[model samples]
Target: AQSVTQPDARVTVSEGASLQLRCKYSSSVTPYLFWYVQYPRQGLQLLLKYYSGDPVVQGVNGFEAEFSKSNSSFHLRKASVHWSDSAVYFCAGQNTGGADRLTFGKGTQLIIQP
Candidate 1:
């Protein structure tokens, strides 16, 4: 079984501040990893993903993440976040043999303060 853990349920950050969202997972093998962002009433958009090869992956809207096999972690980072970046972020995974069933965390709601 594959699972993910997002330590924070909500995060508040000042506009233009650097941000890091923590994510940890439990799996016997490396699975397809991804970060999705959901705005007010919109659907989830893929931020980034890691299938194989490079450990570092870049995403849309100035988002990035690094995958660590040893720690079983994939943390999202941004040098600076805008007010519009205030949205719910979810960490998800897909198993190779599961026909791509996405497993999502509880999600982290990010609030931006001016």
Candidate 2:
């Protein structure tokens, strides 16, 4: 089974500060990792993904993630964040050999301080 865990339930950062959201995954085999963001009352939008090739992949809005097989982690990072970046972030994983369904974490709510 593939599962994702986001230890932090909520994160607060200054408007211009850097941000990092933690994610850990477990699977029998290599898994497809993803980070999805959900704005207020809006559907989830993919922030980044990692399947193969590079361990680090760039995403929309200057977001990026690094995958580590040894650690079973795919953590999202941003150099600087804005108020609009405040949202709920979900860490998801899909077993390459299994169904197309994605197993997601509980979610981490991002709050930007003024």
Candidate 3:
């Protein structure tokens, strides 16, 4: 079985500071990795994903992720974070066996400090 783990349950950072959200996964083989964000009252939105080819994929709003098969990690990074960037972020994994299912992490709540 495949699974995702987010070691940090919550993180606080000052505005304009760089941010990195850690994610680790366990699977039989390298699975498709994804990062999603959820606003206050909005549904989860895809930030970025990695299936193959490039290890680093660009995401929306200055977000990008690097997939590492060696470490079985797909961490998300932001050059600079804003107040509006505060939200709950989730990392998910889908097996390449053609299943439409995705295993999600517990999620990390990002808080911005003034």
Candidate number achieving the greatest TM-score relative to the actual structure: 2
Per-candidate TM equals: 0.92, 0.93, 0.93
Task: Tell how far residue 12 is off in model 2, in angstroms.
Answer: 0.3
Q: What digit string (tens of lDDT, one per residue) describes model 1 on residues 18-63? A: 9999888888334689999999999999999989888999999989
lDDT of 2 by residue, 1-114 (tens): 437889999999999999999999986435689999999999999999999999999999999999999999999999999999999999998855767878899999999999
- Better by TM-score, candidate 3 or 2: 2
Ranking by TM-score: 2, 3, 1
Model 2's alpha-carbon lDDT is: 0.91
Rank candidates, lDDT, best first.
Answer: 2, 3, 1
- Between candidates 1 and 2, the TM-score winner: 2
Where in model 1 is the C-alpha error above 4 Å?
Answer: none
lDDT by residue (21-96, candidate 3, tens digit) is 9999997434688999999999999999998999999999999999998898999999999999999999998855
